[model samples]
Target: MDTYRTGDEGRAAQETSFRAHIAIAKRYGKPLVIHDRDAHADVLRVLDDEGAPDTVVLHCFSGDADFAAECVRRGHLLSFAGTVTFANAVALRDAARVTPIKQMLVETDAPYLTPMPFRGRPNASYLIPLTVRHLAEATGADLDELCAAISATGDRVFGPW
Candidate 1:
């Protein structure tokens, strides 16, 4: 299941959608892929209030170091996307630097947020390597090591790598 919503909306809407997601997750027993734009704090509150599933992933995460640390502490997985390759993503790179390898994940958010070397073009899963390379550089891990770790994380979250 996917749950993407802004945390900056009125409290009522956030609560309603959050509850709806929780109910859906409970009924289906599927992982929730959450899209958090600029509402890290509010998103955290919602997760705390409703209690998160074992497979809660923060997709295309753009939060600060403190929020990343808190998410890690709470056992949520952080999935980086093509945005990590952007010049404005210094904070994201820093977050990747400090996050544990086991806790890190990667995605393309495909057809959007294409990584460097193809930023202006339409994206697909085949272009994952671009973002993968950037993630390796940011995290200071070798290509193979980073790839293996990312594969492992994918398996753990989405199942059957």
Candidate 2:
């Protein structure tokens, strides 16, 4: 399952939750999809301390280039949503560029974060192809190659479809 948890105001609670998530993911052997909003540093620190699972993805990655680099260094995958198609989402787009192709994935985040050309509309898995297309163009990856890469990444992280 895709898990999304926010960090609390205090670092202690945040760390606690982060550790708990690590434990839960390990226990279930489930892939983790972390939503790190305005808590990249703390999230990274907690991950460093507790370590990440075999398959961990930073969904809708909003951090800077350095954070993206760090995630890559730690063997964490980065997943981009429709926001990457926005004109104001330059940082997110740039992060996609710097991220290795094998380390990239795509999601529609259905019912939210709809990609360009479909903004304001309800989202669903059907919109994934649009986001993937944009990702391929942004990363200069061939459409077919990116599709295969995305599928492989998804399988590695989420397992067997």
Q: Give the number of the best model, judged by TM-score.
A: 2
lDDT of each: 0.80, 0.82
Candidate 2 residue runs with Cα over 4 Å from true position: 1-11
> For candidate 2, lDDT tens digit of each residue in 50-139?
878787899877777788888988888998889999889878878888888899988877899998888999989899888888888987
User: All candidates: CA RMSD in angstroms?
Assistant: 2.9, 3.1
37-144 per-residue lDDT for model 1 (tens digits) = 776877888788888877778888888778888988888788988888999888998888877878888887878888887888887899788888988888788989
lDDT of 2 at 97: 84
Residue 82 shift from truth in candidate 1, angstroms = 0.7
Error of 1 at 45 (Å): 0.5
TM-score of each: 0.87, 0.88
Per-candidate clash tally: 0, 0
